[model samples]
Target chain A: MDTKTDLLSHHISQQFNNELEELRNNLLSMGGQVEKQVSDAIEALINADSEGAISVCEKDTDINAMELTIDEECSRILARRQPAASDLRLVLACTKASTDLERIGDEAAKIARFAISLTEQGEAPKGYIEARHIGNHVRQMVQDALNAFARFDADLALAVAKEDKSVDREYKSATRELVTYMMEDPRSITRVLNIMWVLRSLERIGDHARNIAEYVIYLVKGKDVRHIGIKRIQAEVFDQ
Target chain B: MDTKTDLLSHHISQQFNNELEELRNNLLSMGGQVEKQVSDAIEALINADSEGAISVCEKDTDINAMELTIDEECSRILARRQPAASDLRLVLACTKASTDLERIGDEAAKIARFAISLTEQGEAPKGYIEARHIGNHVRQMVQDALNAFARFDADLALAVAKEDKSVDREYKSATRELVTYMMEDPRSITRVLNIMWVLRSLERIGDHARNIAEYVIYLVKGKDVRHIGIKRIQAEVFDQ
Candidate 1:
């Protein structure tokens, strides 16, 4: 290539990388907001704090705006630069990560809404420690998944994937307890059911966070480790 | 700028478009499989068909494989072609759609699992009616979103977005009734709760489809209609 063309190509590559760094920062910021929301929503539910719930609902707009901005920036980069190969993957992954992050934000909002309703009602069932345990499990899974994505750590990503099963188990156990609670107390069933939905939503946020990790694995390693068994993923990573 | 380079560029663009078309077809086929799974899962739950539920579980492998194939194809195109502007948007949108479709398939599988368990338990309560209502609404939403995507019709996409509210409404009503059912008879609580989760899964699938429709609007109209009201989207469309 000629000198001018070479310089232009280098400039484009540098600019693209900068955009990616910006996207990464945006995703991490959004991730932080979502994690806080999940944690705060759970706290509100446990404490029955209606105002905390309202604050979570209101703060969702910030997450939503971050998502929109990331999306526009990524699109603008693509339109302007037409980056190829790994650079293109970075752009595509940013868009996917943005969507997942946005949904995570939505899940948090759902939890907050449930907390609001539960607070208005008055009481949760007695001796229901399982929901809190499950919520913590889901919340931690989300935290670890975001950490994995932020650092592009495939091992961390794999760990996050494995952790999902625990969340599933917790959810099922909570389901059983909630069913019994409803069976025993007719009046508390509505409030209890709402909590179950909130639990389910938190579980789903973990699921989406795992998705973001899978994207990270794809972006960094070009491996599609989704749907396969953990043993297989481990073997594949070792073999590579 | 040279004739040879221009010809090479044209050839690559054609190839990139072909890859995109293949990706679209693959995503549509995946969407179709997911739609069937969602419908069959509801049928299994409502009619107590264990075999149908099992098949949905088995078919998940196929859906998963299709998702992997599409992801690889998209990454390959982005790497090889370096498409820009609208072309890049199309690719990014397809990647996003692929992930959404995969999650939709996962939700359907979860529903099928619920169906299997419910069928094993014999019968569910009146909540099954609510499940049917939710299933129909969400299934239609997925169908419309895919149709909107195929046509790249922003108006149809907007309509699909509008339909999400209806699914949300139905989901809330379903929750209220399920709580009532659980309160009325603890014996029926377990079965009703399982059905409520199936409803939640379907509602999430509807949300994912709506996200896809929004991406379609972004791709076709270059407008970010997410988070904004439909009025803003309409006004922006006209302003363009």
Candidate 2:
């Protein structure tokens, strides 16, 4: 997939253009790895595949490396090219987006680690359905967030932000049910708590995806749409 | 407090140096706000002070706004001055640090939310002592991290990293004990889970503080010390 967002507005210096282009591509590359890590981690948890989970853990280093590389490129471009206006926003967004992606990757590794630990103690009585349901939603959110960045689509990014609300709702409801189940059966608390942590990680992944989307909105619209509600973001970003 | 870090060295442009200086000071100011939020949130939890918790929640917006403002200034300095070498690292570090401080503020708000929830549900049978213990430790870690950035002290930053290990250990042991308590007394699971979440928030706060400290190491030592273990960061960073 071509990762260039075409957000760059044709620089005179071909070298500078290439530097900006490479920065966006590298960020998307990191995003792809993170999206896969999240997907594989959820799969590992559902299937009780410890090896799969460990592999997810191992691949995290690559994502971390990608973040450092992309961040360095951002600084390099800022220092060398002194990019202004749209170009500066792109660099700033890439720097912030890479951090968000790395965090999403970290959360995925955490879910995978939970999978490994869960495998050791054997499967639980409940919560895999909740995991799969919320897992698919969050995975899509992460993927869509990256796509939003790749295409520079604030509308799609807005959709990602809106989906986070639903994902969070599902997470809270699932945790409440699990808490009730634990109260009914004391033996299941530990395993259920592990599942709860997985749910928590999934919820957090959705949040980081929302963050990336927010950065995209800022990139394209040049507005900081955070802390404001969806209605305000809608009115602010698209209206202008 | 003077937040310059004195790490800028001798830049030719006094205005550029002032911009860098203001960025650092603004970041430290944001950090100060975050530190207070965490402390207040923990205090609210221990005292069941809903008003105090609500204040922490309210103050979060200010921190969030501060993050955007400082981030904007970082880009401004990057674009206008196009600082290189140590100046470039300072800008990058400021960008990353603001994000960490914003996240730390988010975690504090989360803890405050938990505090408010716990107030509605009434106090749990266990976990307050643990909250007090880990809360103070994490609060100290946040302060030390900001100081490390302010002073450009890698040694102090390393100490913050090491302290995180102990904080995690304390957190894990507390959660384990709480888990045991919940299992033994099934009725306490809900309240205990709330306290557990407060601990989770505290743990994440420690992680963010450690991240800020790691960025300090990078700014001072010009090394990316993430994912590497403590001893590795210790030897690689301080060896020179």
Candidate 1 Cα errors over 4 Å, as ranges: A1-14, A126-128, B1-13, B237-240
How far is A15's C-alpha from truth in model 2 (Å)? Answer: 1.9
Chain A agreement with the truth for model 2, given as TM-score: 0.96
What are the clashing pairs of model 2?
A: none
lDDT of 1 by residue, A1-240 (tens): 242232123443676666767777787888888889888888888888899999999999999999889888877877776666555666777788888788888888888898888778786754237657877887787788778766666778778878877788878777777667767776777777777778778778778877777776766666777888778777655555
Highest TM-score, which number? 2
Over 4 Å off, model 2? A1-6, B1-6
Chain A: TM-score in each model: 0.89, 0.96
- For model 2, residues A96-190, the per-residue Cα lDDT tens digits are 99989999999999999999989998955589999999999999999999999888888899999999999989999999999999999999888
The DockQ for candidate 1, computed on C-alphas, is: 0.58
- DockQ, candidate 2, comes to 0.80
Reference interface contacts recovered per candidate:
0.77, 0.87
